[model samples]
Target: MKGTVLVTGASGFVGRFLCMRLISESWNVRGTLLESESPSCLADKVEPVTVEPLGRNTPWTHALTGVDTIIHLAARVHIMDDHAADPMTEFRTVNVDGTAQLA
Candidate 1:
């Protein structure tokens, strides 16, 4: 109950709100974001972790340590003009693979 809560995609809209709520409840929060993404405004409130692309070389192992709970909010967001790439692959990489790695 007194440990850190890891929140992935903490810079996103809903993720930011969730992190704020957790902070209000007095829980330590650690948030993760991609390298290209900007730092969250909540960075001052929670520890900000920049996660590399999901792969064998990525450093996701260390991020899960001491984490009491993991709230995965990172995923391949849908777009209107996004017919250039395979959505399923993107989703699997970010959502499925990412979650598996964390688990």
Candidate 2:
């Protein structure tokens, strides 16, 4: 069997398709969801992993354990109406910091 693969933001469109394709290829698939209520497009096809938002001191060791590859798809693209004033800060935290945390 191939090594495990961790797909961040697995609920998203691209991630969802990637998970399915990876499963078809016989790779061990693990998915992480950002929103608890997000649709499970690849339900039962991949192991679902829990991961918190990437912030200061965010811990990701548990998420990556036993996983050989990480396909980072999580990102903060839009600032919510009630979100922080700086869009860049929000993006950096989720997009940049999330990648760093995974490393």
Candidate 3:
């Protein structure tokens, strides 16, 4: 909570609140969003980074720099018109694989 923290799904509701609160408490917050830059951030306290959720082979070296903690909030949300043949597999690809990519 006090050290450098990396947050995933930072464009979402929970991620937004968490980053704001952490900044208020004097925590160095680094958040990851799908877009190049999303939801803006505190110039001094929080750094917003752009990253894909299901990065099959993306390297997280630069993103994980100086990060002491990681809060994984990223997920593949189910939409009205489903497309993936296997929802669980798709979920694992993003949620599971993504987490590994970060770690």
**Winning model by lDDT:** 1
Global Cα lDDT for candidate 3: 0.74
Local accuracy of candidate 3 as per-residue lDDT tens digits, 1-103: 5789888877677877888888888888998766655445423456877765565676677778899988888777756777889977878888778667766
Ranking by TM-score: 2, 1, 3
Each model's lDDT comes to 0.78, 0.77, 0.74
Of the two candidates 1 and 2, the one with more favorable lDDT, higher being better, is 1
Ranked by lDDT from best down, the candidates are 1, 2, 3
Could you tell me the C-alpha RMSD of candidate 1 in Å? 2.3
C-alpha TM-scores of all predictions: 0.82, 0.83, 0.77
**Which residue pairs overlap in candidate 3's backbone?**
none
Better of 1 and 3 by lDDT: 1
lDDT, candidate 2, residue 32?
85
Better of 1 and 2 by TM-score: 2
